[model samples]
Target: MTTFLQLHLLTAYPPSNPNRDDQGRPKQATVGGAPRLRLSSQSIKRALRVSEPFRQGLAGHMGQRTKLMAKVLLDRLLAGGMDAAQARTKAEEIAKVFGKIEPQDKKRPEAVQGTTLAFISPDERAFALDLADKALAGEALPTDKELARTVLRTADGAVDIAMFGRMLADNPDFNRDAAVQISHAITTHRAQAEDDYFTAVDDLQRREDTGGAHLGEHGFGSGVYYLYACVNCDLLVENLGGDKELAARGLRSLVRAIATATPSGKQNSHAHHPRAGYVRAEIGGAAPRDLTGAFFTPVRGDDLFDASARALERTAADIDRAYGPAADAVETMDVPKGQGTLAAIEDFAASALERQNA
Candidate 1:
């Protein structure tokens, strides 16, 4: 059983520069016009993946895909009786079919283009392109099979954090998106506090107050946080082939496998010294905390993976209690539910089965 779990984080206090056109204050949107915090969606997602839990669980797969597709294709070509050169060519072709470019575009860095090819094998790439060409020509094609195959092949692939996703999956009451959004909000709130602390503190003032609020050993800021994540078992199965009932069963099996598997742990350590600069607050003012680095001292990859798995198992029990057994079948699995999009998928899968049985 395999599944694709995606985690997204949005800052609660998305910041906005004072709406002043080089003059007096202008009307700004969002809750009382209190200046908002600033952080990109990409930034939050990246941070989550780099969190101790995700780094520990999935490891390098979450960050880099440099030669993944090339490797996939090379293996395929060997299986298909092609020589090294021929295999490479076929792999490139397959990559191209799956939206990966060959020979690297000049405007784009090789690193960026290479990442695209890291996920697919040459044969699958070739199949996908062939499927597309046939569709364009009005020829019968195997779209579902290709999608299913891709999902199956990458079943164990950990491309992102699972903790957040696992939480959403296990707890039917939990809203995955809302959870991520809240996490982002918390980080945003922390970031703003740090920014304010930097603004307020000076060498002379710190000395005046016995260096209490002075920036200490920590360099970047402790407000920064890393979030590890995982998704539910059924969710993964559904994403792979768009099948709900099958996914739910897969999810159950996954839970069993996880129970038997050795647990993983996080490795990254806070980079800066514990005594760092003070953070400004919305009301209570400045306070000191450790400064987590931009990279967060490279936490262990195992921690991230383990956290997600654990979170998912707990979440699953909760979900079953609230949603009951997923009663749908495979085909109509995309319609999402109340933050429980995965369960909604299960319902659809069950429904499909009922129709088939009827």
Candidate 2:
């Protein structure tokens, strides 16, 4: 059975759009008969994947999530001393091995593209690039190219691809199930959507020209939010070609990323990026739980941070009482002023992996 790593986080933001809706307002949902600020799994994962801590830590061990697979391979072929026309033909042929490529068009016939976004890693692009080089040399093509199962094995080296997984509709065999599951962050207390009305004064305008150059209103809200994530160690290892050591490193980096990173949605206008006020890291039964249940009644205390922490403790105790205990190893951290140290959190996460490996 796979060991599961679950992280429970409580963070507070002050009037920021960590995640926004199509209308350019903070995303929200009605919960417990009251509106709660929302942050999608996509935004949360993207933030974590691109976080400086993740980049600095994983450095060369990550993947680029884009549709530039074709372009990437084409560039590599040209650098290998191939002529332009031969490089383009071989590149598209190899690109077709990954996903359906749009036919060459008059607008930009030389450059090919996938039908949609393909979360290909640099390693995968390099692998395809080698294939194109072989095709140029008139070598035999890979018989397995027709089946994506053989072409999509580059997940072994890409941290983001292995953790978040990939989906290729053109070939389901290449799909790698996500080892990590991140939930939408929901506000602990009910909140009302607030507005900020401001105008940009034109730098070139004379004093008598106009009152303001441009005027507009934007939506925002402030609240303490609960975020949850679970990492399946076995699946993570499997995604990385059964490299337990690398997977452990990934989990360690991911914990630091979660503890430090905040979504960069409207930070320029509303710089409200704050880390988790409270964190609960646990290596529990496969059945994972989130403390969103604790806010069912909506915490009503002068100190929402401490109140949220207490509710989490109480709810966790209640679960153990009713469900015969869930955690094998558990640790808690609270930064009431949003200044929690992550040293213990990182050590705790790595210890879980070590224990599982043991």
Candidate 3:
């Protein structure tokens, strides 16, 4: 039986556009026939991957998502005294191991990027760069499949790639399945984006100038958001090449990041940095299920955070009653009630790996 770790969080943000839509406004979703602010799973995962906790904890075991592999290789080769023409040719060969090379941009002819962004592990990046150095030294390198086999990896100490997975369209065999699944966070209560209009004064304005320098308006919203995530502990360990110790560390870092990280959308202007007010962590062999149904009818009360927490607890109990217990054990950190601490939750989630071994 596959063991699973599930996390549910309630965080309150005050008038900030953490995630925006194409119109540059806070993203919104209709739930229970009411509009609510939303934070996309993509945005949440990115925030967690880049959070200080993840960076500090995982350090060298992280991957970078970028399209500049070819450009970076080309620059390195040229700096190593390789001819520019030869460098470009060799760089394209190595870069194609990851993805298709993009057409040279007319505006920036020197920039050579991939058609699609590639998620590359640090080890893979170093390997590609080493190949570039070898080419500069006039070494005859392997071609095509041989080159890709040397450069690509199924799992190469990249915690983020192991958790979120990656797809190499050109080399499907090198793809990895995600071990962690995240849901788009949505407000527990009905909320709508409100426009914030303001004018900025010019610092060097003349005394005679009466009008402001610039005028703009953007959308913002305030509410308690409920976020859900599930981690396949078995798959996580497998993705990390069966390194249980690294898997435990990744889980701990992930929990901390999810509790503290906020999407960086207009954060400078709003400064909306709020930690999760409540977090529930569960571990078990039972199939994973989300508690989003708790807020099917938008929660409403004077203390929105408290009310939302109650709704989540009540929903979990009701579900257990209906379907027998879904989790073997559970831990929670409730700021309002002061029930548990984040450290306890982290330990509880990591214990899943140990339980699986038993």
Top lDDT model: 3
Please estimate how well model 3 matches the true structure, expressed as its whole-model Cα lDDT: 0.94
The per-residue C-alpha lDDT of model 3 at residue 132 equals: 93
Q: In candidate 3, what are the lDDT values of residues 143-260, reduced to their tens digit?
A: 7888988898887689999999999999999999999999999999999999999999999999999998999999999999999999999999998998999999999999999999
Candidates sorted by TM-score, descending order?
A: 3, 2, 1
Clash count (model 2, backbone only): 0
Worst 10-residue lDDT window for candidate 1 reads 276-285
Candidate rank order under lDDT:
3, 2, 1
Summed backbone clashes in each candidate are 48, 0, 0
The local distance difference test score of model 1 is 0.31
lDDT for position 92 in model 3: 92
Candidate that beats the other on TM-score, 1 or 3, i.e. the better one: 3
> What is candidate 1's lDDT per residue for 194-306, written digit by digit as tens?
22222335556644465355452311222212222234333443333344444334333222222122111110222221210111011011121111121222222434323
Best candidate according to TM-score: 3
2 against 3, candidate with superior TM-score: 3
In candidate 2, how many Å is residue 90 off? Answer: 2.2
Of the candidates numbered 1 and 2, which has the greater lDDT value? 2
Question: Residue 328 of model 3: what lDDT?
Answer: 92
Clashes of 1: 48
lDDT of each: 0.31, 0.80, 0.94
